[model samples]
Structures are given as C-alpha cells and as structure tokens.
Target: MQIALTGKLAKAMGVELEPVNDEQNPLFTWTANWTTVWDNRRAEDLLVLVNHATRFTVAVYQVKRKDLKGMPEMIKQAIANTLLYMNINPEIVEEYMSLCGDVTFTRNSNRKAAAWVTRAGLDTSVYIGHEYNGIAKMFRDTVGASINYGLVNYSGKFDDGFMPYEKMVTALTELTGKQAYKYRAFELMVTLDLDVYQAERRIIVPAGLEFTRLHEVLQSVFGWRNYHLYDFTFFDEKSERTTVLTEPLDEYWPGDEEIVLIEGRVLADFMPEHGTMVYTYDLGDNWEHEIELLRVIENYDQESPYLLEASGQTPPEDVGGVGGFVEFREIMLNPDHPDYETMKEWARFWSPELQDWEMRPRAIRV
Candidate 1:
C-alpha cells in the first residue's frame, strides 16, 4: 500500500517517492505544513492523514517541526488502529504493501478530508504554536460523541461521502474471522407499490451500506431528483413493533412510535430481522414502495451499487399522486389526444426523452 506524502514532508524527511502505477494499492496519504498558530510565527507544524479508499481522515497530528522523527511511528500506529476499527487484521494489510507513493501536492487529493475535518469541528480551537492547540484532544472526544450522535450524517454527494464508523465495524469482520465465508451483498427487489403502474427494479448493494446510502441508490434507480423528504418503515411480525428510519431533520414531527435517523444505521442492522420494508417518498404525493430482501450474495466483490434488472419506467416527480399519474399515463399513451403535446412537454422536466422512456441500469452509480 502506498503512503502518499506531501512534497515538503518528503524533503524534510529525505525520503523519495516512487512513480504512480496502475497496480499499486493506495492505503493512505499524509499532508503536512509548518505554519504560524495564533500569535506565534511558524512555531508548530500540522500533519493530516487520510484513508484512500474511504476518503476519511484517519488521524491528525500537531507538533514542533523538530519532532518529525516520531511522525512515522505515529502514522503507523494510526494505520493499525484504523484497521482494527474496521475489523481488518493489520497483519493481513501489511502482507502485500509497499511504502510511499508520488508526493501528492495537488489540491484535489486532500480537499475532501480538509473539508470534513473543518465540518467536524476539529479546526475551530486555536492556540499559540509553542503551546497546546488541543486538536488531538478535540478530535478524539468529538469523534466519540459524534459516533453515537449520528456518525455518518452526510448531506452531500455520494462520491464525497465518508465511511461511517458503524459501517466499517462489520465490513472487514469476515476477513479476520475463522469462517471461510467472504463479504456479502444484498439482492433487493424494490417495487413502486402504486395502483396506477407496475414499476420495479432489482439492485445489489454492499450489505454494510447505511440506509442513507441505500436511499441514494433508490433515488438513482427511480429517476428521482430527491427534492423531498423520505422514510423507511419496518414491521416485525413476532414483536408486532413498527420502526421508522428517516433522514436527520431539524425538527421531527410528533409521533407515538420511536423515530430512528438513518445516518448511522447500516442495512445489515434490519436485514436479518426483517425481510421487507416500506419506503415512502414525498409525503405530499405519498409514493410508497416495497423493498424485499431477495437473498444474500456470498463472496461478493462489487463495491458500488449495481442494477441487475428493471421493469417499467418511474413516473415523473410531482405528476400528482397515483390518480394524477394514471391520468398522465393515459394522456401519454394516446399521442393523438389533445393533451399529448402538453403532457409530453411537462414530463420533459424529469427527462428530456419522455416519449421514448427506457431504464438505464448503468446510470445508477450510487
């Protein structure tokens, strides 16, 4: 695995980085800079390490420039801790790994990590360069608290998303266990349970994915713009209890049942206990869906969500509810009808080619 270092850090440590290659397993990257802190002028240096696959900041260190000798050990310890947290044995990781990649000085390499650290409240506290900046203390305490208080609360694009702590716990557990079973994926049958039409899709996603990620995949498969609120409802027959997982909201609506945010909850949490669940999107329109767990795929290696099959086209958003969609479909089918032109024009808001609608499975990248 390649350990990417900043140009300045490599120069200071007198280390050379090899050229980039297609076959290298990039594990993590490091960036450091000697900069002024508060009233001090270039008194301390900062170091940031980011995981390559998850794009999550593994650790951050702030110390005097002269203490650079210990950075390598600290980085190694951080990597080991990260692997342990992910349930991946460190020995397995070290078996096929090499040190140092090309010095990454590009902005795109570390921008996401920098933004994540800032949003996590790690860069707020300030101190003199020669004194304690409290970054290490703040990061540990905040991360511990945040893990329980909605850890993977991502309100952004799928590619920019981070690997949630809860998700990482079980992702690599099978690797370290005695069982010969490999990582698994879930084959789901997501159907739009509307009276007007029969729209359904078959998708496969990593079992370790959070409900939020699943929500994104659903949006992509259904051709929705995701401009409204949504929730998942699961019912247990034996206990006769109903659980609702919704997006993190500023103010939750009044209800008797317990409401759980989908942020930190992985799909594996409810897959074994519940075979099916209902997803309701756009409360105003009430687009209800039935998601059934078809089966668990053993030894699955696909990292991203994949579309296995699709049936029928998803209706345009805000085409009213079922009744409205039924009427719209009738108008669309009868091209010679008076409202055909108007209906086609309105549907273009969702897709440019409403007349020739087809499901493109490759478009579902989430």
Candidate 2:
C-alpha cells in the first residue's frame, strides 16, 4: 500500500499509530527495531558463510516484531553476534563445515521474523522484512538438509559473501592486536608567501592556535591551494615589512589566514591553515618506515601542497637536492615559530627534550 494507505491501515486496524511518516514527528511505540552487530566491515570481504549462518540463525529464531523500528535492530544484533560466534570465530570458509558447531541458544524460538544483513546499502539500523525467505526459514529450523548442503556445494551463491560486512568484520577481528589494524596517520602543510608566490611547508604559530595538547589533535581546517579548488583566498596579503604581531592577513598575509573545518580534535589540529593551505592527520599511508612521506607523496601526487612549515628543512626539493632551510628570521611570522610541521611529519625532527610527541588543536579550520 502507499504510505498514506499504510497509515490509514494502521489507523483502521488500530495498529497503534506513531510518527512513521514525517521524520520530525516522533514514532509510535510499535516500530520494529532490529539491532545489528556493528563492526567496521567494508564492502567485499570473505565472511559469507558466517553471514549466511547468521542469516540462518535469524531465520531459525522465528522472532516476530509488532513494531517496525525495534524489531529489525534486535534481529540484526542477534544475527551479527551469532555469526561471529558460530562461523567467524571458527575460521571455516564453507557453511556446511559449521553444521556441527559449539552453538548454544542465546535466542531460541523467541524471534519470528527474518533480518537481512547485506552490504547492498540495505537498511542499516533495521530491515523491515516484507516476507520470510530462505534465511527466515532457518530460524525455525525449517531449512532442510538438502538446501543447507547446497550452500557449501554452490560457488555462485556465495559471491556476494566476498563483498558483505560479515567477512570484513571477521577479517578485521582476525587482524586486530596488530599494527596493521591500529590507527596510523600523518599531516602535510604548505605555506605560500603571497608576495613571492612561493609556497613551502609550515604550521600555525601559538598565538593563532588554541589547544590544550597540540600533539594529540588531528583535524581538517580551511586551506588555500589554487583558490578556485578550495574556498576564497585573501587578495590583501601581509607584506614582509609589517610587524608579525599583527594578524598575518592584516594586509592579506597568505600564510596567516584561517579556514572553516569540520569539528574534532584528531582531525582539528592539523587542518589546513587558511592562506597556508595545510593538510594533516592523513591516515592510511602508502609507504612504511620513511620520514617526510608526505613530501614524497607531494612530489608524485601532482596535487597542490598544503602548508607544512615544521617539516624540518622544507619538503625535499624536487630537483634532486634538499632545499636550504627557509628560516623564520627572514619571515615576519617570528624567529621563534615552532617547527611543528617537521616534528609531526617526521620523528627525526624531535629534539632530546620533545620526545613522545603529542599536540592538540590551536587554530580554527575556517
């Protein structure tokens, strides 16, 4: 039935009405909520058998929901947990192998509906089932041995398993407690002197920064590359003659401007400096065991560089030689401008006193 008719059906059957239509309206208490077991599973992993087993568990549970909201959520969570314990935990590829498992009934005969868990952009929080299919019948122990046996024998039926969240979660779990699964990140900053049209790596000074811990923060802030690629750039740049105490952009100091940023500490501190155009806190690296990895990336990416001042001895020059240091003494920023870009990007920049690096956000992304 159409949405209007569905509401009318609910009203006519006295199905206990709630805001199931207009999002602003609160929903009634009769929604089916299926709780999905959430683990960051990417599209196309190898946990289909486990996922299928979880689906089978959902089918066999025979759980039914009166409301639409909570029912799917409950089923999703139950199934995910079951899949993890039943198939994923055992490390078997085919579903038939799990016919004999150390399975115990966390939920037996209490559920009466089916919950689908596919990465096809299927409903995430809940799946309001239209009908109970193959997986649904499994909850009731209704899937015969013939059908169960076919799953192990058939290859085409299991292709989607390679692309679902089930396998991703299982694989991630297997990879956990290892460096490959841990948080890995880096930052890149590029500062441009508007007067010279020459850009280099630089970070924000303390006066323009505001963070309790500068090292720990990772953020994305407004930045300047080619002005057309990002937001607007300052036409009025600060001349070298001005006192650095004045805001960098007093006369349009390109490196001294700020940009808008999505809020967060991990992504906030390393956000692009407005005029400087810095990009930091980059996760997922392409190379291992190398300092100034970003500089290498900048050399190859053919993308505009973000301002990264502390990159200690500006990003290695592309002309087969390390560029000479661009000293703060020559610039208006200050003689004491911290080489934060270098320290954050490469540990070699850390001095004896500044070991175990940790910093926080001190500038606005905008």
- TM-score top scorer: 1
Residue-level lDDT tens digits of model 2 in 100-123? 222211111112211222221133
Q: Which stretches of candidate 2 lie over 4 Å from their true place?
A: 1-176, 180-187, 196-219, 223-366
- Superposed on all Cα atoms, model 2 deviates from the true structure by an RMSD in Å of 21.0
Model 1 whole-model lDDT (C-alpha atoms):
0.58
Whole-model lDDT per candidate? 0.58, 0.25
Superposed on all Cα atoms, the candidates' RMSDs to the truth, in angstroms, are 11.6, 21.0
Q: Model 2's lDDT to the true fold?
A: 0.25
Query: Cα deviation in Å at residue 49, candidate 2?
Result: 21
Model 1 per-residue lDDT tens digits across residues 53-165 = 44344543344566666656655555555443332334444431233422333322455544544433233223222224444432221111122123343567655544444
Q: Note the clash tally of each candidate.
A: 2, 85
Give the least accurate 10-residue stretch of model 2, judged by summed lDDT.
Answer: 282-291
